[model samples]
Target: MSPALALEDLAVERGGRRLLHGLNLTLMPGQAAVLTGPNGAGKTSLLRTIAGLQRPAAGRVRCQPDAIAYAGHADGVKSALTVSENLRFWAAVFGGDQIAPALAAMDLSALGDRLAGRLSAGQRRRLGLARLAVTGRPVWVLDEPTVSLDSRSADLFRAMLAAHLAGGGAAIIATHLDLGIEALRLELSEFAAPRDAAPLSGFDAAFA
Candidate 1:
C-alpha cells in the first residue's frame, strides 16, 4: 500500500521569503508525526504546505487526493449554528454521514442542541476537532489542536487520535504541548531557513 503522506525535499516560503527547506518525510497508515520548534522555525509552514493550504517554493508533497482533514488555529465553526448543525454541515461538505459518531467521540452529545457561539473555549475546540471524525479522511493535519482545551479535553483528543491511528489513519500535528500519543517527533528547526535570511513575519512566526 502507498504511504498516506510523503514530502520530498519540500521547501516553504512566506512573504516572498523561504522559511523551510529540504524537508523529506513519509507517513504510512496508522503512523503519526509531531512537529516541534521555537518561533520562526517554520513548523506551521511545513504543516500548511503539507495540507495544501500554502504553496511550496520547491520540491513536492504527495498524498492521496482529498484524503486529508485539516484543523488549524481557527475553529472553522459557524457561531450561529447549533453544535449538531455545525457537524451536519461539515458532514455534508466532506461527503460523510458520521456526525452522530463524531459528536459521541468528542463527548459533545449534550451540546448538540446548543448554539456553537455559546460554547466555552474548550467546548468550541472539541467541536472543531469533531469535524475530523465527520470527514472520515485518512490523514489528519492539525495545528495546535489542543489549544484552549483543558486537561480532560486534551485526554479526549488523545484518545480520539489513538482511535484514528488504530483504524489505519495517519496524523501530522504541530503543537507545543504533549498529546500522550505515540508519534515520531519532527523538529522543524532542523530544516529552518538560514538565520541570515529574513525572519518569518506575522502570526506564523508567533507559533513558528
Candidate 2:
C-alpha cells in the first residue's frame, strides 16, 4: 500500500517570511517520525500544515480523511465540562466509544466526573492526549505532546505511542525531547543552515 501520508516539495510562508522550503515528507504504516529543531524552526507550522489546519504556500499534502489525528499545544477542553463529558464529547465528535479506554489509559478514569478546568496542568495535558486517542485515527500528528507532563504521565504517553506504532499506526511528533522513539528525525533547522554545515539528509536513529 502507498504511504499513509506524503508532503511533496512543501513550502510555507507567513507575512512574506518563509517558514519552510523544499520540504518533503512521507509517513508509512507502523512508522514513527519526529521533527526536532530550535524554537521558531517551523516544527509546529509543519505539523499544522500536515493536519490540514493550514495550507502550505507551495506543496501538496495528501492523506486519507479520518486517517489523521492532531493535538497541538492548545488542548481545546471546555472548562465547564466534566472529564467524562469531555471524553464523551470527543467520542460523539469522532463517532467512537473509545473514551473510556482513553481515560483509563491516561489514569484519569476516576477523575471522569471532575470538571476539566479543575484538573492540574499535567492532568489537562493527559486529557488532551486522551481526546486524540478517541479519534482512533491511523496517523497521529502531535506537537510537544509531553509538555508540562509529570514523569509518570510522560511514561504513559510514551507507552501509548509505542502501542500505536506497534499496531500499524503512524505518527509525526514534534518535540524537543528525544522521546526515545525509534523514528526518523526531520531537523527543520538544518534546512535553514548553510549547505556545508547541514546534517546528512534522511537520518534514522534508535530509541535511546
Candidate number achieving the greatest TM-score relative to the actual structure: 1
| TM-scores for candidates 1 onward, in order | 0.92, 0.89
TM-score of 1: 0.92
Taken over the whole model, the C-alpha lDDT of each candidate is: 0.89, 0.83
**For residues 1-208, could you state the per-residue lDDT of candidate 2 as single tens digits?**
8898888988754434456778888989988889988888888878888888866767788888779899999988898999999989988898887587898888999999999999999999899998877887989999999999988899899988888888889999988776767999888975552333322222111110
Query: In candidate 2, what residue range of length 10 has the lowest lDDT sum?
Result: 199-208
Clashes in model 2: which pairs?
Answer: none
Per-model tally of clashing residue pairs: 0, 0
**Candidate 1 Cα lDDT to native:** 0.89
Give the distance in Å from residue 167's predicted Cα in candidate 2 to where it truly belongs: 1.3
Off by over 4 Å in 2: 193-208
